[model samples]
Target: MAETNLQVLLRRRPKGAPVPEDFEIVETPVPVPAEGEVLVRHQYLSLDPYMRGRMSEAKSYAKPVALGSVMEGRTAGVVVASKAPGFAPGDSVAGGFGWQRFSCVTPAGLIKVDPQEAPLSANLGVLGMPGLTAWVGLEDIGQPKAGETVVVSAASGAVGQVVGQIAKIRGCKVIGIAGGPEKCRFVEEELGFDACIDHRGDLNAQLDKACPEGIDVYWENVGGPVQAAVFPRLRDFARMVMCGVIAQYNVVEGADSFGGPPGPYLGAVVRKRLRIQGFIVSDHGWPRYPQFRREMLGWMADGRMSWREDVVEGLRNAPEAFIGLLQGRNFGKLVVKID
Candidate 1:
């Protein structure tokens, strides 16, 4: 048996915001699993905007973490010990194992993975939640037609990047909205988007310049200014997939993160018979994991898709990196290497 040193809860119920001091690190004797359980040593920890909701005491998609509980996160790791029949000592798995160096997991929540095919870290990025989010949100909700104009916000980040590239593969004209000129260049030159507009620039003017035919499908990522800019240009009978609203995540109530008053453009949804749907990407009650894996893997193998990761070196940096992600500080998928 190996000794486990872990990061554990110090306190909960964060004030207006969270800081690193809110977390406490402690070491305790590794507990042995009684039955039907496995012990895993974490290799990579996923830090997402959704975690911010967990830090606060709020009703959300899931229950809030209790005080003195391990911080919740999804991780890819190696199984060090197992009492389960099928899982062995050396199997690799991904699960909601939280922000710790090691975790005791039940087979119910763990997913077996093969690292030999793709990089194991991909289990947390393009091949994981982000990938699935892009796939289903675009396919089922957006329903992008060939030759249609597709717009994606946060266009260089994990989800938006894949969404744009996949839209391009489907023969749609892909326009990406991202912060800064460098990210815009990466989206256009490297990712093969038809056009890339820098949101940090004059957004309305730039989008107007890029989207002459109007937006047929809008993949919403950052919701504040970008959404405002894109809304006016939506074509008749357009579709919108509301994904993440990272720009407004930190805004408190009455702060007007949506900018001034609502624009006159939303009336187009009713006038033009548009379709707009918000989704939370957990297969939307359709466990299409098998189909998603097949199509995405095929695209990856054929180089029809690409992915990037903003890998933070340690867990200590997760807070700042996550803050940066909200501000569009990260250029790709953000993850913490915690092994």
Candidate 2:
């Protein structure tokens, strides 16, 4: 174990898009675990669009990270020391330890991960939260059925990829809305999505061609122009799972960012009898966890499911990586590898 732990702290709030100056990297002595606590050494930190919301002081489902405090994120790490049951030194675990190289916290919330089952970092991604986010949202709210047309925005992203792939597994015709052609190709060829449209191009034209039958299930992730394009294409009785709006995460509150106003979609919703529900991954039903694990794990082991990650080295570069993520620069799940 190292004598010190390097941490990334929120130096100041950003006005629009985040800059490196908004974060300050500092080193502190490694903390020791107290009774019932375990010491963790983070190997990889998960970066998602949701972190942008946590950077602001605005009221939300979760509390904002306090100024001068470590930024919030889930981490996959190895235990350095433990004073808690069900954990021991060298045990691999995943937990909400925020942005830091090492941490000491109560083991109550720690999730034990078997490295033999999957790569350690995957616990922060596909085999974990991102996968669960896709599973619960699509299964619970979207309720897609065979031969239905499902469109997933941010198609190549952490959550979007899983949503599209799962919809495919359920026999749905999956159309992915990705940023670039490269991502679109991967979404179609690699993930088995039926079709993929580049959101940067003319989404309306491409979406019209891709889903000629109209969208039955819309997984709304990049909620901006993409949402606007998708609205007019929704079929009657369509279901929309309101996920993250990455396109507007950086925009200053109260100003038009990327999406259109609610006024435009109101009449369409009532006329079409559409069902729209917003959800957070944390609010996923506990009853479905076992099913998610059994099915997703089995799918991965049998080569029916796959995943990708865009790894950025060093904890200090997290801010830049996160900024790139919001711009749709990352082709897959984004994570910071801290040494």
> Which model scores highest in lDDT?
2
Q: Clashing residue pairs, candidate 1?
A: none
Give model 2's TM-score versus the native structure.
0.97
Stretch of 10 with least lDDT, candidate 2: 253-262
Report the lDDT of model 2 for residue 49. Answer: 88
Error of 1 at 133 (Å): 0.6
Question: Model 2 segments beyond 4 Å from truth?
Answer: 258-261, 285-287
lDDT per residue (tens digit) for residues 1-339 in model 1: 766667646365555446667676676677677598998888898878777777776556778877788888889989898998789988999988887887787898788989886887888888888888999898889998899999999899989989999999999999998888899989998899998998878988888788988999999987877887888789999998988787776666446547764446656778888898888977472388768877988999999988888898876666677667766778788888985
Best by TM-score: 2
What's the C-alpha lDDT at position 174 in model 1?
A: 96
Compose the digit string of candidate 2's lDDT tens values, residues 132-221: 999999878999999999999998989988998889889999999998889989998999998899988988889879988899999999
lDDT of prediction 2: 0.89
Count of clashes in candidate 2: 0
